[model samples]
Target: MSGTPDGQGLAPRTTPPSITQRHTALGIEGPGAPLADYRAAFQAARLAMAVVNRDGLVLDANPALGALLGTDPARLADRSAADLAGLREDPAQWAAYLAVLRGERPRMRCTRPLPPVAGAPRWAEISVERTADGRGVLLCLTDVTERADLQARLRHLEMHDPVTRLPNRSLFFERLAGALEQAGRARGGARIGLCYLDLDGFKAVNDTLGHRVGDRLLGAVAGRLTECAAPGGHLVARLGGDEFALLVEDSRGTDQLCELAERVLAALQRPFDLGGQRMSLSASIGLVERPAAETHATWLMQAADTTLYWAKADGRARWTLFDPERNAHRMTRQALSSTLRPALERGEFVLDYQPLVGLVDGVVHGVEALVRWQHPQFGRLSPNRFISLAEENGAIVPLGRWVLEAACRQGRRWQLAHPANPLVVSVNVAVRQVWDSDLVADVAAILARTGLPPRLLQLELTESAVMGSAGRPLEALQQLSDMGVAIAIDDFGTGYSNLAYLSRLPVSTLKLDGSFVRGFRAGEQPNPADQTIVEALVELAHRLGLTVTAECVESAEQADRLARIGCDTGQGWFYSRPVSADRVSALVGGYAPAPAVGSG
Candidate 1:
């Protein structure tokens, strides 16, 4: 022992040996032998281990513990475990550790972060178990930082899309479901919306420019979308292959959704430059906004998908809002379209003719043959209900052929019945029949097969159809006209008043559109402007050596005005609504022709 009172000490001061060394100094007796064996085992163990007294102080530690802490075993002794592990830096963590050491917890386990012993900070799973001998607590620490980091990376990859790094379909659906659940709790007035967008003509890019350029385009699009403003905690996701979706939670209303859609569309308007190629792109968006409580995620997505199809159909690069009523009507139209081909095969269609009377003498000069669908379910559907459908599905080619054959056959029947006065039959021709079909060949075949003279067959085309004609369409019309068939422009005055083309085409007559005819009523004063336009049109037709036919003359006043204006032929309810072939025969049989303005 050393003492410092006023002079020199009996022996120089020296640090005492550690507890384990002191235990070795004493002989291995009854209880001391087990303690000595435990000391040897603790020193030989590979994992980090420590013994902590009730005060949270480290009473002893092994070599592994010293290595884990980046300090020597002697330096670790008598230091608090919390201090060595760095938990004492946080007051709440320190308090929780103290509580576990006070016997308040049966067995405590936690993950603690330690200061940077290496370049990066480390993590350890620290577990405390009460010693069986009731001396103190034994601490066990396992390094799990690498595993935790790997798990985090795996989670990120699972939730995000690889191409755009946006939320994947699964994660988008998950967040959508969560938003719906939150909306359900709002009781009422909680609106949510979704904008489903598809890049228009995107496949053409991949086909012509290669998929790599397409991929670059998609990435540029994604970057722009991410930069777009998304209100109310909205999120954007890539739904695979040129499709993307935006989820707007707590949407204000349809106005907000529309605004978002507009913004999205506007974003795509800017041209994209990739691989030194400047390309312009547009998108079609389907917007669906509704009470989240009343709709599920699947239903909302379905509505958006259905509406997106509509947007594409109506013409790409537009937005379409979901309308239940409009959708129902479209469904009905689809059903009707599905049944049309079979109806044609079953011979469920019939021809109805309306007389074109001479305005000078009220005698039937010609008749217009209009197709009627004698649908078994719908009874009798007009061409208005199904003609556009046939055109859209490419069925118009076959359907138009059938009409031509039937009308020509009927014209032959009329010619045979009235050998003295044969009447011309005007058949409406669809734009698709003119452009997508071998119209000249079809008409020639029908005319020869039915043995009907070409001069007696008039094909009526809409003004817009004829006005837009060029290249193949113009050549086709010229061929048909050269075959002695009469070509007439129907629905005149409603479309491009292209007078220059009128003289250049093979057209022989102009059937002024019904809208203009309806303007000049029988008893009322005609609209001066309409009257002037009609007068000017009739004069123009005459100067061009083309007959002028006024359609939809509903009263004597209209007929007289039409006759006064030198319209050679007039047809409408005033003459009679569309009638059967027998009615046309009767009208033609009991009529007389007289000289009118240019009829002579």
Candidate 2:
């Protein structure tokens, strides 16, 4: 299908055998065959053929050949094709024709003109072969004009996308590789610039405009992108989906990269005209400019990728370049988050419990479950170090489940060991885990699997995690609460909350924001205002019939103030640090009521 011999064209076309005899003037040898058989076969075969004398005189022609010449075979015979072919440029067909006749050279193909019947003179591939018996020559011709056109189309499809007609990933990588290779060979080895672009809200376009319009917008975008390239040294490629990559070669300076980037940003700032609708969007660009020396494609691409994420994080329509110091910190966080799940299976992650003690009774109440990762590379990482990343990357689904099961198992063990205290365990829930996963089912499964009583497990959710989760999430929360598992609002007051939402939301406990408690001792004097604020929060919570737990009670003075304010429970370093289960047991049994506590 691909490797075709010279003078053979696969595109469907017609050529006059008389036109072929014109090229026989170029010293090409033809096959020996009777004029009748050759004539019949030439007309029947796709290839055009004509019989000619050594002098390039047309002796006989087929009907098919006449059609290609825009004339009849009877009219073409007895005519000198060489003199007629000379009317076209490069008219040396006869010189080569004489060489074959003199046995000075082998048969060959030559380009000759066949004056058009309609538009213009057409180009034909002509082959003249020597007869085995050494009589007159047989000339074969194929119209290669159409073939050349088709080859152009095939190359376009291979390098460019059919839909947007933009350079696809393949072509982009090809150009990128070439740029890097060239950069490496240079004196200073200039840097290659990468612009990783992603549409900010293209999904909204598909949803609103329909895919047809979305496709048109992409095509128009492709056109605009092509206009952003530096004169002759840049390539833009669509890396599939809504992502695009730009490779700027000879980008000796960052100034060129910045200029092109700004141009792209300005172009996208204008609204696109799609049919009657005017639409607009922005792109987040990640940039990494690396020298060609000893650099691999993977590192360049990854640097660009990291920078692009910064763009998304800092809000779109902006570009961020890779920084070694910043990327190293990010890499460390990524390494730890990646190891989170596998760490669970390997027993490298464990839970530490901080007791939520009862103020009135001055006894151990429940324990807040805190997770820790003893990473081999990172040593030990607190939840704050890697939690947000886990939630963003969907690692929380696995992490939350691990915490739930582990706490449930430990809670069940402690309840049996210390039946009177019967400490409850609370596990924090991430928004992603709450929205995308069946938290109730997971909780039920963990409880059933761990054989922990429903009353001894508590689920803690942030206010924002519950704000938008109305229908099914509310239903799930109610179902779990009804099963006697307690639900608490963690980090209260850090997020927006309404009294109505507080009453409507299915919850049993409100953990006071640590900020307020931490703010206590920093006051100029004994701030009655602080006392009044804590009392008001407790009164409001008590009105909703929700138990209030004051967090960060670091001193006996703060504990006394919180307790006097009717704060039902408290947990902080004032009692004991989050510690091992054995340590928790010893401390809880030996816990003596502290006079008061304060932390700011």
Candidate 3:
């Protein structure tokens, strides 16, 4: 009485009267006692209702029931309910109807296509209830076609990325898991592949161009990726941001994945016209393939991400295959990066000094401070292994500050120990240390704390870093230089040179890149080109009033040539390799004449 009979698969609503209830409510316990009132009430009902005998034949019908079935009320009479509902053809469906007809099941409910009558084939939930008298069953039909359509529409929206209309990360993983399960149950092992791609320099697009343009670019990229994927029947999805993924089921092997990745890259190479502005972009892809049984969706994605990283790191716009060995190395590198801050706090980092020798006299004039990690497990580790990592994560600021303080402390100690001849300590400063941090403040604080004159501290930055600097970064450098902290462009001539701009900066020294110094061979005639370039560079520096320091002077001949070329100083293995503070004292000891190094 509370809900429509047999409402199991249908929404609940007030029940239509049972045949016996109809008779009783109409006050007609006997045949022919009938009722205009009973007919009117039944006809006015909103739900489609009917009465069916135990033989599954319709005994009576309301106007709503007649209209729903697309039959006249007279035509509905004595018609088999199973036939009218389109269930007579299927034995299983008919049997379900028979249960309620025989009073075995109090109610029966099902959603199915009714016999074609009018417009489209209408789908409905058919509910049947056995009468208390066990003579017939009452039926109510509810149309659910529109509801089903609404649900389908909602499901489509939920599983797709709004921007690109591609399967979102959620649906991608779901399909991947399902594919893996299918592959696991197959006789011949099926392989699956995932190609993870990220747009290179996407952030720059967002920063320089508006996000509206960035979004348009992403849409364009997604379209290209979709075209590449369509040929191979691969599924492409946007995994958020500028990252997208391709899922290839039953993949042949790495060759197929490689081809797909190459196609994707090629597709992206074409310039995009975003609102009439032409832009060229490239993507870095990570290709990973394996037996489906051997990997899950999560790990597959992880491996793909790792491979993609190497592709970007190896210089972007290319695809990199997943290599376990490379992954192991990355894991180690990640572990090291994680421990760097803690290592600094634990005093696990120490400075080693390599003398910046006077090339002409071979005298140890100054020491370039090299920071080394006295890693607990790995022993002494060189800066090459972790310096770039530090720069990437902005850890270089603190790490460089610590190195500056330590080097200055040593420089002060050297000045004290040998008042007649003091040593200058050149500490390498990362670009991030200059741009992202307060270098002037840090240097001033450390210089004052260590009692080391600012002139004794030479801050070395890469040629690229100095050349790229502008605005606040250049202003910060000027401030430090004004404070008497000497600024040297290390590895000069390695980057795009801007001598005109370089002359305007407060740069005090030019350290020739190791490549140029290595070009000067020992025990052989110096290459004329190398000599010309070095001489030219040295002359240019001298004209700018900047001292020239040649790096990587590995042989006496190389050193002699540099000094002869009027290079003011040199630092390399030809000098002492980076040594401890104790060794620094030993190297600088007993140098005659002026031992005192002055502030800038």
lDDT for each candidate structure: 0.84, 0.76, 0.83
lDDT score, candidate 1: 0.84
- Residue ranges of candidate 3 with Cα displaced over 4 Å: 1-157, 160-169, 185-188, 196-233, 236-245, 261-286, 303-339, 376-379, 436-438, 464-485, 496-508, 539-546, 590-600
Which has the higher lDDT value, candidate number 1 or candidate number 3? 1
Worst ten-residue run, lDDT, model 1?
Answer: 1-10
- Ranked candidates, highest lDDT first: 1, 3, 2
The TM-score ranking, best first, is 2, 3, 1
TM-score of each: 0.63, 0.64, 0.64
lDDT of 3 by residue, 1-600 (tens): 221222223333355445666455424456775566667777899888987656565657888887887768756755567767776666777777777766677887888776555555567888888766676678888888787667767988998988889999999989999999998788468899999999999999999998989988898999999999998899999999999999999999999999999999899999999878999999999999999998888899889989998999999999999999989888878988999998999999998888887765656778899999999887889999899889887788889999999889989999999887788889999888877788888999998899999888899988888886889889998998989989999889889787886788899999998988887786677678878988998999999899999888777667767777889888877666778999779867553121123221
Specify the highest-lDDT model's number. 1
Backbone clashes in model 1: 0
- Model 3 lDDT at residue 167: 93
lDDT by residue for model 2 (290-317), tens: 7777577889888888888999999889
Regions more than 4 Å wrong, model 1? 1-152, 177-192, 197-231, 240-243, 249-285, 291-298, 306-320, 332-340, 374-380, 467-479, 500-504, 527-529, 591-600
